[model samples]
Target: MKEKIESKLREKFPNAILEVNDFRGDLTFLVDKNSIVEICKFLRDDEELSFDLLVDLCGVDRAKRKDRFEVVYHIVSLKNRYRVRLKVRVDEKDCVVDSVTSVYPTANWHERETYDMFGITFRNHPDLRRMYMPEEFEYYPLRKDFPLMGIPGSLQLPKR
Candidate 1:
């Protein structure tokens, strides 16, 4: 299954995929961030692959790496009973990527959550807002640089 998916992706988008890994029977692909939406659409619409389910979408903080942020998408093919993980690495300077809500509507909330927690923006998201944080909150809590004890003065109390 991994081989088939890899072959299909390579055939479709040569030089677009950055890396491929097989760990514990799971296939993970690191793809160009600019082509994420196209890649995801192909995975879902392809006849042989049929990755129709978007199980999860999240972000990772790789502060030490040259590309310090990574957006991960876990997709499953109910028809084929297989799963694959797609990753797009974004540089901290440009922590934004094309939204997959057009390809997978389920990504709406997931993208919001990722944005709320990691400060990774999804361009063209219909209603991009913080899902878990207050509208006034200014910091992304999940980033490596966020203080473990939380930000000071973030919470305000009513004046007496």
Candidate 2:
């Protein structure tokens, strides 16, 4: 089941960096950040593989990678009964990926939440603002390097 979807995705997106995480039975593909919108459109609309559901979109911060941020798209095909995960890496200086809200309406809020936590800007995401975090917080807390507690000069920690 996974191989069939992978082959079709390869045929459809030849340049996408494709990988099969067989240990967990997940189809993971990485495409250039700029091509995200195009790739997502193909996945959702292709007749043979109608991945009509955008399950989630989020970011993963790779502390060791030169490109520090990865935007991950979790998609499911209700008609075909298949799933795939798409990833695109972006540099910390330019942590941005194309928004898929136009293709999948559900992506709007997901993108906002991702942006709020990971600081990966979804270009053209409608209402890209902090969904759950306080508005006063200036930095994204989910990045691997972001400090959980401030240094000594800052507020005191809760009693342990």
Tens-digit per-residue lDDT, 68-159, candidate 1: 99999999999999999999999989989999999999999999999999999999999999999899999999999999888889968789
RMSD to native for every prediction? 1.1, 3.5
Model 2 has a clash total of: 0
Tens digit per residue, CA lDDT, model 2, 1-160: 6767778777777776545465477778877788788888987888878899999888888988999988889999999888888888889898778899999999999889888888888888878889887676677778877788733443444689
Error of 1 at 63 (Å): 1.0
Q: Which stretches of candidate 2 lie over 4 Å from their true place?
A: 18-20, 150-160
Candidate 2 C-alpha error for residue 57, in Å: 1.1
Give me candidate 1's TM-score against the actual structure.
0.96
**Which candidate should be chosen as best, given TM-score against the real structure?**
1
Pairs in steric clash, model 1: none
* Candidate 2: residue 138 lDDT (0-100): 73
TM-score of each: 0.96, 0.86
Question: Among these predicted structures, which one has the highest lDDT?
Answer: 1
